[model samples]
Target: MEALNKSFFLFLASRPSLDRFAKRWGSKFGADKIVGGETFEHAVPLIQNLNSQGLRVTVDHLGEFVASEAEARERTLECLQSIRMISAHDLNSQLSLKVTSLGLDINPELVWENMIQIMDEAVKHDVFVTIDMEDSSRTQATLDLYKALKKKYNNIGTVIQSYLYRSDQDLDDLNEVKPNLRLVKGAYKESAKVAFPDKSDVDHNLKLLIKKHLLNGNYTAIASHDDAIIQYTKELVREHGIAKDQFEFQMLYGMRSERQLELLAEGYTVRVYMPYGNDWYGYFMRRLAERPANIAFALNGLFKK
Candidate 1:
């Protein structure tokens, strides 16, 4: 039953027709709770509020899978604008974006050019940029781009999904860069040949990756909502005598609000992954697919206002 729910939402997430319909409604279905806003400007005050509460933030301009160079360029400009805004507002925030939105599929050269523009602005503003991981098929290409960018910029980071069979070795490969990584138990649906087919395996692997990455002495962002995972991290860091500065906790905005605050109160750095923009349908569906508990708020959103 749980698997069926996941697969159903995943299928809904991929439908262009549904995506179009969602845009017409404009974040009406509880998506406004998870999504920051339809634009970065609309999200500015929200970021300020989170910062005031001592919670750091990373804002993603919600979008992906661009099919045109023009669209990709537009995405790049949005990212550039976001960096400048983060700096101008003096907000405690980082920038996160999907490479596909910047022409990863349209053309590599185009994507690289777009990335260089965004990276230049990010560096100038002293804002960190993290390249979000997509599905299994694009993992290597994403990592390759990240490695190239890492060579040129020190304020860059990328996600590593523990569900993938290749992630363990990918960490070793990335260790050379001393990467600042946000470790996640991936969201996209993937074949068992490439991803662990069991939730237990995925959870166990996440713990292992967290341990390996932290002990590797790289900056680690342990992104999870599970209490078990949180407990494991606390015990592991304490046992290893790891410094608090070496790692932090990350959670999607509006999902684990109380836990995020508790962690912050406990002196742990907690970053809220707040995504803004009109292209929110796909992201919203994925959040529902990730945890059925999210559907409650989503349903609540429907009758709201």
Candidate 2:
């Protein structure tokens, strides 16, 4: 299975055009079809529907690596606008932002400032913000921005990828200042030197972090569709006697609906990440690479088309 997974990922990486194809197909399927996009306008209705289904939404503006500080400022303002709109609806939706979109690639300080501006708007609207973790190269900058924001806004949170070797220490460091986090097994393709080359190692790290966070009184969001991880998280929650609402079980919008609903039915808080916009191909490609099943399905769809 692992070999198949790696082989499929390699095939995915080689086909850069597949990203464009996925995006076009995704948009044609409408907001219900894919998650993560260029803007949040197309996502609002889908988000409303998910909220109606008793699932919270995390809105993410789809773009990475700003060309300049001005662009980052504009993107930050756009995110704030989305947050304001969600707040107006009084819906169960929050914003997820990428630091690079906020000028981290140009200047770390500019990224921090952009993030602070967005958080300021969030504070005004009483909305929460989650900082999405990027590739390993930007992890330090993302962390710095999160640390700075957390010192000011208690409602601000960030993500930690279990794939990185430094993640354990990163978690410990972040926990010391603020513990609210979204934990994922990671989706970015990275070097074996800096990340766990084996799936077992990443999965093992994910389980360990869940155990550590749940027992340490932190409200960590376990964002995974793996059955064992989900079951383990539930078991840990039960053993630790953590309240159902203390944490949320998060999943991507189109993936593992059965497990998501099952957890929700069991009284666990479930948040569905409903991303939308024009730039969906990049997001879909990442999703396809993350799960071999998704890759197979996508490839079949392509051939059928």
Candidate 3:
């Protein structure tokens, strides 16, 4: 059953046509429960609502892996506008984006150019942009893009997947810059050669990365839904006398709402990673792949009495 769930969700993540169909006609399946909506205009209120609850937000547009420069530019422009709007609202929201969404696959140079323009816009608004780390294939380019841009702009940040085998060293190499990192338990399908295949190993690595960042005094966002990880982090930092401002916790938009609010109430900053856009298929499938129980959530909607 575990293998079946893994394979089934991965199959969905790999199917773009099915994703498109679901995006167009599958609202009843609980996509909105996770995704913000179809546009920036639609996502603002959602972000505002979370902010009202004392939770910060990192808004992401639901698209990645563009096949053409035109599509990549289109996504890039949307992100630039998002930064402007986020600033104008004075809302407690930042921006996150995928490298592949900016044409990394088509051409790394083009991706870098587009990313620079977006970062330029982010700086004007004083809004930080986080370059989301994709799968292993593009991790090098993602790091390269981040290293290149961090030298040019101080307002930029990027994610580091804890599942990768080299993450410990990656963090060390990036320590000189005091990298602002969002440490995620990686959602992509990865090979054992390059990644920690065991969940236990990934969890350990996640905690290790968190500890290193805090020890180095770098601002880190611990993105996870696991109770043990969160509690362990809290205890670790408490034992080390780490201030609340030193690090923050991040959760996806639709998961663990009570915990997000509870963390905020405890005076810890919690950022909600909220995604919205017409191209939500890929994002939704990836979510399902990461948490197979999400498939059951969708099925419950379909089979509700």
Candidate 4:
């Protein structure tokens, strides 16, 4: 039943028509709960509120898979503006972006150029930037781009999905650069050939990845809302004597709001992954697919005044 719900929402996430429709209504139907807002400007105050509460934030521009060079460049400019705003507003925030939105699919060189431009601005503003991981098809390409970028920039990080079989080896490969990684139980719909199809395996694999990455002595972000995963991280770090500064917990904004505060109150670093933009349908659907409980708020959003 859970698997069916996930597949249904995943299918909805891929429909281009629905994406367009959702954009017309703006951030409605409960998307505003998870999504920051329609634009970075709209999100600035929200960031300020989160910062006031001592919750660190990473803001993603909520887009992907651009088909044209012009559109890709526009996305790059939006990211450049976002970095500047984060500095100007003095908000405690980092930038997260997708390479595809910067031309990863159109041309690798184009994406690199766009990234260099953004990284230059990010470095100037002293904002850390993370490249968000997409699906299995782009995993290798994404990592290859990240490796190239890491060589040129120190303020850059990337995500690794535990559901994928190659992620363990990817960690070993990335260890050479001493990566600061966000480990996620990947959200995209992937083939069983490339991903662990069972939830138990996926959860267990996340623990292993968390241990391996932290023991490797790289800064890690354990991006999960599950209490079991949270407890596992706490115990593992205690056993290994890992410094509290070495890792942090990350959760999507709006989901597990209380737990986020609880972790912060307990003296643990908790970063909120806040995504904002008009292009939010795909992202919101994936959130619902990730946890069916999210559907409750989404449904509530439909009838709420």
lDDT of each: 0.93, 0.79, 0.87, 0.93
Q: How do the residues 235-255 of candidate 2 rate in per-residue lDDT, one tens digit apiece?
A: 888887888867888998877
Assess candidate 2 and give its lDDT: 0.79
In candidate 3, position 283 carries an lDDT of 73
Clashing pairs in 3: none
Worst 10 residues of 3 by lDDT: 1-10
Of the candidates numbered 2 and 3, which has the greater lDDT value? 3
lDDT for residue 57 in candidate 4, whole number 0-100: 99
**What's the CA RMSD of model 4 in angstroms?**
1.0
User: Native-vs-model 3 lDDT?
Assistant: 0.87
Model 3 lDDT tens row, 139-197 = 88788889989999998889899989989999998998889999988888888999987
Question: What digit string (tens of lDDT, one per residue) describes model 1 on residues 1-305?
Answer: 77788889999998998878898875678788888888999999999999999999999999999889999999999999999999999999999999999999988999999999999999899999999999989999999999999999999999999889999999999999999999999889999999998888999999999999999999999999989999999999999999999999999998889999999999999999999999998898988888888888888888877
Question: Could you tell me which 10 consecutive residues in candidate 4 have the lowest summed lDDT?
Answer: 19-28
Give each model a TM-score: 0.98, 0.91, 0.96, 0.98
Over 160-184, each residue of candidate 4 has an lDDT whose tens digit, in order, gives 9989998999999999999999999
lDDT value for model 1: 0.93
Which sequence of candidate numbers ranks them by lDDT, best first?
Answer: 1, 4, 3, 2
Looking at model 4, the pairs that clash are none
